[model samples]
Target: MNTILIIANLLVLFTFIIHTFGGDKNLKAIEPEQDSPKRLRIFWTMSRGAFHIVSIDFLFATIGLALINFTDYFQESKLLLNLLALYFLGYGIAFLLTLIISKKFSNIYFKMWQWLLMLVIAGLIYWGNS
Candidate 1:
């Protein structure tokens, strides 16, 4: 589990580094329907939306350290690891909720992709841990 967490954190960091550097975003595909300002706004929103996942992922990865450190802090600490699991579950819920309720990001392809990917990630993590 310690190794799992270290790897997960590393993966999150890698993802953030990739996005922060503007790597491989499919920006050319989305088109504005009518108003140029609206188009610009959507483009901006989509562009920024990609970074939020990295931020959240990095945060969770930081928390994953508790799985390692907590055992030393308190002997026989399985609950700390359990909290990490709940963190993932809660994060997933938050992502799903944002996906459903964020009207500002509506009609944006990036948000849709973010929402779907988060849910999928949540499921995979849950299943993998279970």
Candidate 2:
């Protein structure tokens, strides 16, 4: 289980790094060029900030998980473990709620993908507790 977590965290960290650098292209592709220069600039700036924040947040999460798995630090903290599980559960619930209530995204496949991801997170939490 530790090995699985280490590998998953590493992969997520790598993906976050990639998005931090490459996300601008995807954002630009989605945004229209005909928009006003001011609006475009503001959008791009906000997008870049969001990307950076996401990358840093993932980096911290990855490091925290790695430490919990591989080091003596926080290894025996039951409270921390419970908090992590709660975080996972809360995130899963958020995904499910969003998928259920949001009609803005009509893609069933995407909804299914989110549901599966939520299940995986819940499973990981359960495994950790067990």
Best of the candidates, lDDT: 2
At residue 61, candidate 1 shows an lDDT of 53
Give the Cα-based TM-score of candidate 2 against the true structure.
0.64
Query: Which digits, one per residue and each the tens of the lDDT, describe model 1 over residues 46-95?
Result: 86676566566555555554445334654534564455556655756776
Task: Return the TM-score for each candidate structure.
Answer: 0.42, 0.64
Per-residue lDDT of model 2, residues 1-130, tens digit only: 4655555456556656665667667676766456668877787778778767866765776676677767878856456555655665665676677677866656764745644554565466446655
Off by over 4 Å in 2: 7-11, 14-24, 32-44, 104-106, 109-115
How badly does each model clash, as a count of residue pairs? Answer: 0, 0
List of clashing residue pairs for candidate 1: none
